[model samples]
Target chain A: MSTLIVIDQAPYGFWTGREALDMAFSLAAFDQPAAMLFTGAGVNWLRKGQRPDGVGQKSAEKNLSAAPLFGIEALIADEHACQQYGLTESTMLPGVELVSNIRDVLGDHKHVVFAG
Target chain B: MSASNLPERNNEGFLEYATDWSSDVASVIAAEEDVSLSDNHWEIIEFLRKFYNKHEMSPPSNRLFVKAVKDALGEEKGNSIYLMQLFPGTPAKTACKIAGLPRPTNCL
Candidate 1:
């Protein structure tokens, strides 16, 4: 079964969100199918040209960009969250699907995990 | 190998002085992990060294390590499973140790 990891926080403020991504990577390492949903402040993570060096945190962009390599091909961003952050598909990392109904997407996964 | 035979390292086996790291040191550490060094392994070790040189720190976690590898090497060799096959238990920890980089701080 696959796990849906929901990220709800902006990067660099805390390590929790990054840690959650780590868990996703770890699970993928063992051949687990995983997907990610970006919501709330998490949509900010999908924005392009993030320079997290100023905050002394590695940019999550690279990680998100590489998620497909880890079998995490399904990346969904909440439509409202994207609108709230003024982000469009062009502004987000390539291949992310922006969805208006997140509940339907959540229903498709057998397990769900939240990080904020 | 005993500590005396190895270069000075921190308690976790990371090099106390990164400059002291060499291919020989990496081989020794990999041997301890029962991993035979191949060109594939050397590629990652060299990559980690360059990453540390550039960033002044090892990739802080597996996610970052995967991303860094993907950025440097491309998608085929950068996936988590590919790395795990080369460095079984935890690719970031195992690779950083063999590369003589300091242990990544935020890794679980």
Candidate 2:
């Protein structure tokens, strides 16, 4: 069964999203079906041109780039969150699908998890 | 040519800065692992360097490392046996070190 990992927190503001990403990576490593959903402030993770090393945090944009390689099924962002964060198609990561119906996305997966 | 001339590395011997990497440095690191560079080895190393440049992170674990290689290079070179043959120990750890990237966080 595919699992949907939800991240609603702001990128770079907390460790929760990174841990969730690790979890998703781990799942993929084990040949499991897993996907990530970015809602609320989490859409910032998809924004391009983040240079966070000066702040002592690895760039979330770069980290998330490994998702496709690691076999994470998909990266879905909430459309409202993208709007709230000023992330347009040109400014966001390539191939991130924006979805308006979170309920439908959640229903597509057999299990759903909300990252801390 | 000399240890003193090498770029700054971490306690685990990872490059402190990925930009510090070069072909000569890769040879030096490979020597430390008792792996002499070959056309086969460089193919994976170059792929790894490119992967790090694009992803900004090492494949965090061996399985993911293999998967990433398969995604890019296809199945013939992506299996654990092929990677382990090129890199004696954990292939992800050894290749990333030689490729001048950060240590894979979950390698152990």
Best-fitting candidate, scored by TM-score: 2
Summarize candidate 2's per-residue lDDT along B2-101 as a digit string, tens digits: 5668899999989999899999999898988999999999999999988887778889899889888888899999999999999999999999999999
Residue A66, candidate 1: Cα error in Å is 2.6
| Candidate 2 local lDDT, residue A83 | 90
lDDT of 1 at B94: 92
Q: What's the DockQ of model 2?
A: 0.64
- Residues A5-81, model 2: lDDT tens digits: 99999878899999999999888877889999999998988998999878888888988988987889999999988
- Model 1 sits at a Cα RMSD from the real structure of 6.0
**lDDT per prediction?**
0.83, 0.91
Compared with the true structure, model 2 gives a TM-score of 0.87
TM-scores of the candidates in the order shown: 0.65, 0.87
Quote model 1's TM-score for chain B: 0.93
